[model samples]
Target: MAIQSSKTVSACLQWVIIPTGSHICMAEFFKTSVTWVVDFHYEGRPRRWFKAFGPHDDPFQQMTDTLKDLYGDRAKLASVRKATDEEELQYLRGEEPKNSYCPTGR
Candidate 1:
């Protein structure tokens, strides 16, 4: 489910469940006025895509809130931080970063 805000900008939230029983979520911010283009793996075995949109200011919070709302108490928000360039690259390449924040409480 995507949450649309009353702004001209939007953000994307993506997540993947790893084999270690941890989930990694990434939030990418962008403006609605500009054409945002992202090319990466979207379909394959053991891979899924979930997207949500919110205000451009704080995508991490929006993502966390959306998860919590969807999963209720079962949702546990772990560390949230900005993904470095290398981390983003690794994610684009279908690799989880070593420094990724995984949901450990689940």
Candidate 2:
């Protein structure tokens, strides 16, 4: 579930509860599950990464999450697009593309 706030809430107040002053709402955002091929840079070298997202997942948000998990502020996402069937198959089969670099920095 994603927590979103109304316009009435100020930017600084968004992080904390105003008790009786602000109105906050919790909403569920949903998107179709998708397999994405993400192009990014790691250690100044271009690389590729793939992942399947859940129905509620956002691709851009996932990219940020990946950046935090893998590079801790160094990783940068370049491109994101739906994965082709062959690419998805390779990802599922635990195989990496011959022409692209894919490494788990962790």
Candidate 3:
């Protein structure tokens, strides 16, 4: 059931059609979520930000979709992964370097 639901979520993130009878998973069922630090270069300058990945979400694709909008087709992705505890803390404390970082509470 989880696998099927994951497929559904993946399809949804990609805007792909999921055939009938596919299971859908709710975000509540996911107990472990991660805060990703997305670093990239958009239009020749570095852009950094945080994005949360919930249980029903596809992390990489979400970043791709989001960065695409801001960075355009030529955006260069530097890295995308779970944020460290220190990184998260710095962000919460408003100490992160000036960038596109937007603080959304975990």
In order, candidate lDDTs are: 0.38, 0.68, 0.68
RMSD of 3: 12.8
lDDT of 3 by residue, 1-106 (tens): 2222344455447444454433333344334667779887776777777766786677778788877886578787788888999987887687767744434321
lDDT of 2 at 49: 70
**Candidate 2: misplaced stretches above 4 Å?**
1-32, 98-106
Candidate 3: residue pairs that collide: none
Using TM-score, rank the candidates from best to worst: 3, 2, 1
Residue pair clashes in candidate 2: none
Model 3 ranges off by over 4 Å: 1-32, 100-106
Question: What would the TM-score be for candidate 2 when compared with the true structure?
Answer: 0.54
State how far residue 80 of model 2 sits from its true place (Å). Answer: 1.6
* Stretches of model 1 off by over 4 angstroms after superposition: 1-55, 97-106
How many clashing pairs in candidate 2? 0
Candidate 3 similarity to native, TM-score: 0.56
Candidate 1 lDDT score at position 47: 20
